[model samples]
Target: MTAPFPPSRPSPTTLIGGHVLVAGGLATGGLKYAADIEAEVVQVFVTNPRGWALTDGKPSEDTALRESPLPVFIHTPYLVNVGSPNAEVLEKSLGSIRHALRRGVEVGALGVVVHTGSSVTQSREDALRQIHDHLLPVLDEIPDDGPDLLLEPMAGQANMLCATVQDLGPYLETLEFHPRANVCLDTCHAFAAGHDLAAPGGVKAMMDALHAIAPGRLKLLHANDSKDPCGSGRDRHENIGAGLIGAAAFGELLGHPAAAGIPLCIETPGKVEGHRNDILLLKRLRDELA
Candidate 1:
């Protein structure tokens, strides 16, 4: 549209001028159509949502999946309750994450996105320790072929581990700072978590915090618009511009210095209109910023 985004100001660390990868592939055709549109990246769920479970698949697609020219990512199963207080649930959670990561690797995906989840019980410190204990060893076992672990922070509520960008530091620190582990900040969730990403300097503030906490581990952005107001802890995602955060903030985000080179995965609702409209809006804003 704008003659290939002329190299101008310090372009955002994010992969600039590119459309966000639509959120789901397994349950929707949007993923398939998106690929044909020349999208450079994509994010998808390899299993059932809302829990730590997986959907069955054919063996042949594994090679083609991994080899696809698109830079790909995997959304972990929702059922995998990493913070569950019950030992049985904890076991299931570990298995779920492991299986999900393995599936992502087999499919040739680059990363597996996990919620900066919280405790099913009220034990905050215990949950954090359990998380470090449960996750660290499993991470070490990941082969070179395994997909990267991209921890997406949740809204600050109750016993959440990654409410703020800085909170992830301790957990990550406990792990000895593995190279393949990183973060994916969701725009809506950040707002819901009480970070005003819409205000001037907010985006950069979060970026600075992320850098200070995780250093080079910031890898992706879940560019979602929130339905609820800032600080609400709700999980509703609205269409890009129509939402409370407003679409223009995406410009702030994409224009920020820290977003460089990472994919912005859109977890918005509505189909192609949902993603395409946001993509169009983002490109326009990006051009304006450019």
Candidate 2:
């Protein structure tokens, strides 16, 4: 088989990389896998992904990451749902984010990723209000140099606050456009949410919409090909270039003017080898696409 990557190193300025949640410890596993892929940017979970635990057990690992030149991002536990109407769940969600932000700071993360969670019981307005009520205090507490709180839009599931990129405007407005609030655009989720990344000029169109909503606030990119067709509303993540969205769509995405400096992290389904290949593929495309 041909090598996926040539000997050339990827540019750290673009910060394109992957989500490395390996079998062993997060602190070591994430960095090792990233190095293997020549990834400049990496996303990792500080604690268990499925649970509400906010503790980081490896201080040495965190210190290593904090001291490293690689920029790190932390994905909050899936259980964090600040939009929940349930008071207990709301409290837990707020606590989870609060803790995650602090951990991000300690680990020298550029940002902490949180999903734009669903609103089950209340109307969208009420849900936004609840989020505002709970999150404002948390934002108030964040130090100026703390990592940004990046909101990742979901696959347009029912009652999701930020179902589309445009939907982020209201949330940011509610937060009074706090400087620390930024965005993470997920390609698969964007496709599933009815943004046509596969169509011609679609990537540019999406960038235009995002720029209109919050100018220059897109801090992270979750680069993944979608498993299902567009508008499927599913969150399945396929590897780069192997899914319905295809390779050309990502080429267009990389070449777009608005995507110039944003960090691209592949959240595609993969082990270390798979991700390394994917990263190499993206790097090759980035060169040719540019």
Please, what are the lDDT tens digits per residue for candidate 2 over residues 1-290? 21222233333256679887644666677778788878988898887778876685578887988887888898998988988989888888888898889998888999999997988878989988887888878888888779999989999888888877888889898888988888999999999999999998888788778877887788899999999998889999999999999888887777765677678899877677888878888887777743
Please give each candidate's TM-score: 0.87, 0.93
Candidate 1 overall lDDT versus native: 0.71
- After TM-score superposition, what is the CA distance of residue 271 in candidate 1 from its true location, in Å? 1.2
Q: What tens-digit string does per-residue lDDT give for candidate 1 at 193-227?
A: 88887787777788777766776677778888889
Worst 10 residues of 1 by lDDT: 13-22
Cα lDDT of all candidates, in order? 0.71, 0.83
The numbered model that scores best in TM-score is 2
RMSD of each: 5.3, 6.2
Candidate 1 residue spans exceeding 4 A from truth: 1-31, 36-38
